[model samples]
Target: MPNIKSAIKRVKVNAKANVANSQAKSAMRTTVKKAENAIAANAENVQELVQSAHKALDKAASKGLIHKNAAARKKSRLAKKA
Candidate 1:
């Protein structure tokens, strides 16, 4: 509902960014959950799951989707579990 041209463009761009960020965050959370489940179940692919989770966390942090410290903390916790 932005009347100004620049404002309308900004709104559109923000909407696109929001969708992309949401997807990235969702994927990251799913990866972390998978790693946690694998660890708890004593699964054979626990290492791979953990590694993917770490990668997802790093990607999210680097993209500003999550705080760097937050990502580090999650990574540490995942490591501990593994």
Candidate 2:
């Protein structure tokens, strides 16, 4: 609970941003899981899955939702699996 009005507003803004960030992170994770599942299933759509995963990771990194190195690491691992 923020005592100051400005602090209360800031908290509200932060809560909104937190929800948005969480959604983005969840999307990234879902995309990565899809890619990994495709790889594991030996699906013909592995390429598409990999591409989607890469794009999602890049977007997350660009948005500052994830670290650049972390994104690169995820891309590298996915590429290797693909």
Candidate 3:
């Protein structure tokens, strides 16, 4: 829909970034959910799950897929649950 060349390029770039960000965010959320579920179930592997979740959150935050403080908050909550 963008007629201008730069505008068209921008649109494409944005679309690509959006897809990548969405995937990263979804993965991060899934990891967090796993950690939470482990906690809820009193699973012995909660620490391992939390660690992986924190790593995923940090990776997402570093890539600008999620806010740094939001990631930190989530990590803190996950840690607290363990």
Candidate 4:
């Protein structure tokens, strides 16, 4: 319960950003998991899935949802797996 108008606005903005960040992070994780599973199964679409995962990681990192180094490491590991 923010008493000041500014504080109230800040709370609303923060809540919106939180939801957006959560969705982005969730999508990134899902992409990575799909790639990992495909790699484990030796699926033919492994390359596509891994590529999408890399793209998702890059997007997340660029958006500051994740650290750039973390994104790079994940991408490297995913590539190694594929």
Model 3 agreement with the true structure over 1-82: per-residue lDDT tens digits: 9899999999999999999889888998999999999999999998899999999999999998889999999989888888
Tens-digit lDDT track for model 2 on 5-77?
Answer: 9999999999999999999999999999999999999999999989999999999999999999999999999
TM-score per candidate, in order? 0.98, 0.96, 0.94, 0.98
For all candidates in order, the CA lDDT equals 0.98, 0.97, 0.92, 0.97
Candidate 1, TM-score vs. the true structure? 0.98
lDDT of 4 by residue, 1-82 (tens): 9899999999999999999999999999999999999999999999899999999999999999999999999999999989
| Cand. 2 Cα-lDDT | 0.97
Backbone Cα, N, C clashes tallied per candidate: 0, 0, 0, 0
Worst 10 residues of 4 by lDDT: 73-82
RMSD of each: 0.4, 0.7, 0.8, 0.5
How well does candidate 2 match the true structure in TM-score terms?
0.96
Please report the TM-score between candidate 4 and the true structure: 0.98
Against the correct fold, how does model 3 do in TM-score?
Answer: 0.94
Instruction: Give, for candidate 3, the lowest lDDT window spanning 10 residues.
Output: 73-82
Best candidate (score: lDDT):
1
What value of lDDT does candidate 4 attain over all alpha carbons? 0.97
Deviation in Å, model 4, residue 82 alpha carbon: 0.9
